[model samples]
Target: MNILFVADPLEQFKIYKDTTFSMMREAQRRGHEISACEPRDLGWQTGQPVTGQVRDIRLTGNADVWFTETPRRLAPLHGFDAVVMRKDPPFDAEYIYATHLLGQAEREGAAVVNRPASLREHPEKLAVMEFQQFTAPTLVTRDPAAVRAFHAEHRDIILKPLDGMGGMGIFRVREDGLNLGSITETLNKDGAETIMVQRFVPEIAAGDKRILIIAGEPVPFVLARIPQGSEVRGNLAAGGKGVAQPLSPRNREIAEAVGSALAPRGLLLIGLDVIGDYVTEINVTSPTCFQEITEQTGFDVPAMFVDALEAEVARGN
Candidate 1:
């Protein structure tokens, strides 16, 4: 199998922490050839497909790095059995354009996991609102009056950008919190983006659970992300600790509902965040809970993911 990853520059990734690197490593171990290129590498040549520089990728264990040489341009989007869209996000305009290009590749018969159309339609936070019955109170608005009303109603609310990822700009506004004005001003400047105001789930003090779903089935393990002292965000990138945790009945129910809803849409991978019994977020773009879950539970998530990808590729062929 020849696999191509549409992702960030290789130098920016910490080998162990990056799910793309982990998947690439596992794919290589399974005897699949791998290469990678950024979204800018994709373009059409006179209505004919053409791609910018692509380099062969190699990963070694102890060194925690990838080795690549000068890139060579090639025909766009053919010859690869699978293309993994693993770009990290703020999900800006560039990301959407990349999805459009990838969707074209999918039409050409490549097994693009999570389906490009589905990825474009689903922004991580907004997509989960479709399952509001299973989630905490959430409000998407930019009006200061509306946000203030929500804050007054909930008393404890979390404010975050609607399209942000990796827990960026996530804020918890407590009853006595004083910075709402500044926060709102910053988030709303330039008429840039709307913020998500959610009723803060207090169960977060215990931990935030991240459940990984592959091929529409929930992996057996969950990561309980406990925030550091005085921290309100429970994201690993935000100084939270990930401990292996088992799913409770409620967690399983939420996962089952979300899985059943998404599987038919060709979203082969997802990571769902549950704080207490309330589902907080549904991560679709390059979700990553696999490493923490595997490290704690001894589950072979990489192998399972590879198996699912292989199966999808087989079906495409």
Candidate 2:
């Protein structure tokens, strides 16, 4: 089997922590020929799909790491059995363009995971708003007046970029917050990128939950990401600590609902964020937590993910 991973440069990866690295390692272990090319490498030449270069990849050491050898030119989307869109994102125009190219590939009979159309259509935060009944009090707006009103009503609010990943640009404002003006000014500049403002769930002081879903089924383990001292962010990138925990009944319910809703759309793999009982985010763009979950639970989630991909490949055949 041949697999193509559409991702960033190899040198940019932190082998121990990157989920893409793990996925590549697992695929290699299973004897699949793995290759990589950046999204920008995709293009159309004389009405046929083409790419700049593709490199064969392999794991190098005791760690589930990755190293790519020399690159070779290949037909754009025809040779690989599966293409994993594992690029990290701010979901900008380039990301949308890459999805368009991958969607074209899928139409031409290649299996593109997380279906490209769904990836373009579903902005993680906005897509889950359909399940508002299960989420916290949330608002999406760039208007300072509207944000201030929401803060006044909720007394405590969390603000984050509507299109952010890995918990970047997230901020929390208390009941008597003093920096709302400056914060909103900085975020809402540059032609009106709205922010997500939600009523802060005090239960987050305990920890936020990360649930991994594959092929519409919950993976059976959850990580409670506890924030460091005086911090409000629960992202491991933000100094949070990850502890293995079993899913509560409520957590299982939310995961099931979200997984079932998203699976058929080509979002075959997802990491859902739950703070307390409220669903805060649905991470589709290179979602993490696989390493933490596997390390603590010994579940071999990377293998599970490979199984899902292989199934997709079989279906395509």
What are the clash counts of all predictions, listed in order? 0, 0
Q: Positional deviation of 242 in candidate 1, in angstroms? A: 0.6
Which runs in model 1 stand beyond 4 Å of their true positions?
Answer: 50-52, 68-71, 190-192
Worst 10 residues of 2 by lDDT: 62-71
lDDT of 2 by residue, 1-317 (tens): 88998999887888777888888888989999888889988886667764536877666665544464765676667668888999888799999998988888787777888889988777888876888977999998878999999999999898888767767888888888779888887777732778888999999888888899999989888989999899888888889999888888999999999899999889989888899889998888787877888988899889999999999788878
RMSD of 1: 1.6
**What TM-score do all the candidates reach, one by one?**
0.95, 0.96
For candidate 2, the per-residue lDDT at 176 reads 89
Whole-structure CA lDDT of model 2: 0.84
Q: Indicate the TM-score of model 1.
A: 0.95
Please give, for residues 29-117, the per-residue lDDT of candidate 1 as tens digits.
99998888898888765566545367776666655445654456575576688888888887889999988888877776667777889
**Which residue pairs overlap in candidate 1's backbone?**
none
Q: Please, what is the whole-model Cα lDDT of each candidate in the order they appear?
A: 0.83, 0.84
